[model samples]
Target chain A: MILHSIGWDDILQATLATLAMLGGSLFFTVLLGLPLGILLFLTGRTQLLDQTFAYGLLSVVLNTIRSVPFIILLILLMPVTVLLTGTSLGVRGVIPPLVIGTAPFFARLVETALREVDRGVIEATQAMGGSVSQIVFRALLPEALPGLIASVTVTAVVLVDYTAMSGAIGGGGLGDLAIRYGYQRFKTDVMIVTVVLLILLVQILQAFGNRLVIHFTRK
Target chain B: MNSQPSQPIVSLRGVSKDFLVGGRAATALRDINLDIQRGEIFSIIGSSGAGKSTLVRLINLLERPTAGEIAFKGKPITLVKGEELRTIRRSIGMVFQHFNLLSAKTVAENVAFPLKLSGVRSSSVIAERVSKLLARVGLQDHVAKYPKQLSGGQKQRVGIARALALQPDVLLCDEATSALDPQTTRSVLKLLAEINRDLGITIVLITHEMDVVRQISHRVAVLDHGQIVEHGRVEDVFLHPSHSKTRELVHEAEPENDELNLGSIPRGQIYRLTFVGKRAHTPILGTVAREFGIDYVITGGRVGTIRDVPYAQLTISFTDGNVHGAIARLRASGVSAEHLNGANSEAPLKATAT
Candidate 1:
C-alpha cells in the first residue's frame, strides 16, 4: 500500500521543513514590509512626510516588484537565493525568495491599511500638538491596527502558496515532499493528505487573523 | 457673555488667506483685522464659503495667513516654529465640527491624548486630569467606552473634555455644535458657556448659525465673501443688523411668518419698534397710545433678553389716525422705531436714533 511507503518520519520531516520556511520567511517579510509600508504611507501625497520624488521612486520600485508573477520571481531569484542562504535546494534557500516575493505584496497591503486611517483623526492628533513621530505611533498605527492584522493574515496565506511553488524549484517543504513522493511516485494518498493539510493551515491562519482583528477593532 | 474690557488674547492684523484652487487664486479671507478679547466668547458667523472657518483657523495658526500678522497674547504666532509653535498651539485647544475623537481610544484615553502629547508622563496625573475634564463636560460614566459607542452629543463631550485637558487659555471651536441636533447643540453651548464662566477660557467659535451666536456669544463678527462686513456686541448685532447678509442670517434664526396681519384696520403706517434696556420692560406702547391720543394695534413681535440685556421688536399698525407723534414719544423713551411699510423694499425706514 502507498501508506507503507510514506512513513511517519517522512511526513514529520516535510511538516517541519514547511513550518521552518513559512515561519522564517514570514518574520523577515513583516520586518521588512512594515517599515517599507510606513515609508510608503508617509511619503504619499498630502501625507505628513509627503515628498513627491521619494513617493514616486518608492511607488515605482514597489510596483515593479509586484508586477512579476511569484513563480518567475522564485526562479529568477535562485542565484541571489543561493548566495544568501549558501544553498539553493533546501528550507533556508526557499526563505529568501519567499520573503522577497511577499515583502512588497505585504508592504503594498500595509500602505493601503495605513491610508484607511481617517485624515480627521490625524488632523485631530496634529491639533493636539502631537509631533509627527508621536502621531504615527500613537494615533495612525493604533487606528490602523485591525486592518494591518488582516493584511498580515492575507500575506501569510499567500506566503504559504508561494512556499509551495518554491518547492517546484527544489525548495524542500510539504510541496516538495508531495511532488517528489505523490506526483512522481504516483502516491495518491500522500497528495490528498498534503492538500488537506495545506487547506487546514490556511483555515487556521485566517481564523486567527480574524480573531486578532476583532480583538483590536474598536469601531 | 463676557463683557469685561480685558486685554485682547488674539489679534489679527490685515490677515489674508488665498488658496490656489485648480491653478486659480481664490481668497478665503481678505485683510481681516480682528481682536478676540481675553475671557470673551467671540463668534464669527457667516454663510458657507464666507471664510469664517479660515478666520478661526488663522487665530491658532492652523491656516497661515497669505500675508499679514497674527498675534496671541501679543506674541507673533506667524513667526514661531517647532517647539515654540507647538507650545503656543498647546495653549489653544481646538474642537472640530465632527468631534474627531480617536475611535480606537476609550473615552478616558481620548481625553488624555493631548496630555500625553504634551508629554505628561505620570499616569496618575493623566488619569486625574482626564476624569476632571470628563466630569466637567458631564461624561464621567463613559470613560472606558470607545467613541463609536457614544452618541453625537457624547462624542462632542469627549472632544470638549479632550480640548480642556491641558487647561488651555483659548478654545477654538470650528462649527463644533453644527453636527449635533438642536437639543444637543443647546446642551453643548450651555456647557461651553459654563466653561467660559467658570474657567475664564476665551472661546472663539465660528458658525453659520446665527442662533448659536445669539445664544451664548458675547461679541459677534459677520463675515461675507472673505471679509468682515460687521462686528459688534451680540445684542447689538442681533437687534440691528447693518449688513444684508447679517439681516438674512438673523431672519433665518427666527421662525418665518406667513402673513403680516394689519389687525383688520384701514390703511395705516406699520411701525417696527425696537425697545432696548429698561424700555423693553416698560409699557411704552400703552404710554404712547394714551399720551398722544393715538389708537394702535399690535400686529407681531418678538421680545427676548440678548446678552442679558432686555430687547424687543414689535410691529404695530396705527388705527384711526397718524401716530408720528407717538413715534416721537416712543423715541423720547429710548425706543427706536422703523416704519415697516416699506420693509419688503430695499429702502425700509432706518431705526430712529435714540
Candidate 2:
C-alpha cells in the first residue's frame, strides 16, 4: 500500500505543539528547580546551611523521581495531571507530568553547577560579612551563572524528548502526530517529518544554551 | 588613627584550634597568646603546617578557637554570632594568599562588594568609594577588567582594595605576598607599610618568609609546630635569636651569613662584632684597632637594616697586638663583641685583657 505525503498545516501544528510544551515546561522547570537546587547545595555537607537530615531527604526524593523512566512517570501522574490541568491528554495536560519529570532532573543539574563554583569565592563572601542570603544571591549565583545556563540548555533539550514521549498517552506534539499517522497508518512521510523536526528542535535548544553559557563565562 | 596608639587592637588569650581529621582530633594551634598593638605591623612567621594561618584566622573569628578568648579593642568576641559576628567581621578585613577575588566581577565591583554587603545602597557612593579604593591600590585604570585578566600582584592589590573598603580597624594578611615574585613582593610590602602608616590600621600578617618579617613587621612571633617559640621586636629577634627555629629562619633569610667558612681563615683570634643604630655607622672598630695596636683581617660580615634600623654584623681575626684590650674598648663603645676560638662557634665567649 502507498502512503500519502504529510501536509504543511499538520507539520506546523505539530511543531507549535512541541514548542508550547517545551516553553511552558522549561519556564516552570527553571522557576521551581533553581531554588530547589540552591536549597540542595546550601543544605549539603559542609555547606553554609548544612543539615544532614534535610540534605539526605531532598537528595533521596530527587534521585527517586529522576530514576523513574519518563514514560512510566507520565502514566503514574495521570490523575494528578488531570486534576492540575483539567485534562490529561493534550498540550496543557501533558505539562504537569513533564515539569515533574524534568524539574528534579534540572535541579540536580543546578546543584552540580553550584558545587562546581570555587569554595574560596564563597569563603571570601562570608568573610566580607555577607549574610546567607547575600552570599547565595551575590556570590554563588553570579559565579555559577555559566553553569546554570548550561543546565537550562540541557534541561530544555531533555524536555523536548519527553514531550515527544508524552505522545504515548494522547499528548499533542510532533510525537502524537507521528504516532497516530506514521505508526498506526504506516505513513512513513509523517514519521520522517516529525523525527526531523524533533532533531532540529533539540539542536536549536542546545546551540542556544551553549551560546548563553559562553556569554556568561568569565573564567 | 585612633587616639590610643599603645592599646592593643586585637588580642588573643590562650587560644587553640583543633580540627577533626579521619575521626581524630588534631590540633592546628595551641596556647596562642598574642596582642597586636594599634598602628603597628605584627607578623607571625612559621613554616607550612605551623598554625600561622589558623592564628590569623582566629582574630577575625573566621576559624573559631577550640579554647580561649579573643578580644577586639577590649571586648571579648569569642562568643559573637549571627549579625553581631558579621558586624565584627566587617570591622576586620582579611586578605588571602590566593586573593580569593570574584572571577565573575570586574575590579571595581570586587572592591565594591564589601561596601554593598554592609548596606551601602547608593550607587554613586559605592562607585566613589570603589574608585577611591582602586586608586589607593594603584588599579584605577583597570577597574573594568576581570580578575583573570590581571597579573598576580594586581589581583592581590584588588584583594587589598576590597579589604580596605569598609575602612577596617585591622587588616589580616594570610600569606598575601607568598604567590608573588620577589619584586612584586617588595612592592606589596611597601604598599602594606604605607597603609599601616597612613590609615593606622593594625596589620597582622602570617608568612613563612623571614624576609617578609624582617622587611616590614615591627614585631614578630615565630611559630613552630603549632606553638609560638619566640616573640619580640624584629630587631631583637634578628640580633639575638634564642630559639633554634628562629635562628634557622634568620639564617635562611641571610644565606651569606651561613656561608662563613671558618677553616679558610688564617690562624688568629676571631671576634664577631654586632652593631645597631648609630653604632653601625660609627668608626669604633677602627679606633679600637689603631689604639690597641692590633692588626686584624676581616673574615665575614653582613650590613643591612631590620625594619629600617641600620645593623651590621662583622667577624674579624686579630693577627697582632692587644686583641683583648681592643675587645674591651669595643664592648665599652656599645658594640656586642663575641670571641670565637675555632670550633665553628656562634656562642659569645668572655674575653680577658692581658
Query: Which candidate number has the best DockQ?
Result: 2
- Best by the lDDT measure: 2
Q: Assess candidate 1 and give its lDDT.
A: 0.86
Predicted candidate 2 versus true structure: per-residue lDDT over B1-354, tens digit per residue: 234456688988999899999999999999988888887899999999999888888888878999999999999999999999999999899899999999899999999999989999999999999988998999999999999999999999999999999999999999999999999999999999999999989899899999999999988899999999988788777767778898899888886543256676677888778888999998888888789999988888888988788999888888999988888888888888776775646654323210
In candidate 2, list every pair of residues with a backbone clash. Answer: none
| Clash pairs detected, candidate 1 | none
lDDT for position A176 in model 2: 90
Instruction: Label model 1 with its docking quality class.
Output: medium
Fnat of every candidate, listed in order: 0.72, 0.74
lDDT for residue B304 in candidate 2, whole number 0-100: 95
Individual DockQ of the candidates?
0.76, 0.81
When summed lDDT is taken over every stretch of 10 residues in candidate 2 chain A, the lowest stretch is A1-10
Q: What local lDDT does model 1 show for residue B37? A: 92
Candidate 1 lDDT, B37-82, residue by residue in tens: 9889999999998998778878767678899999999878887777
TM-score to native of every candidate shown: 0.93, 0.94
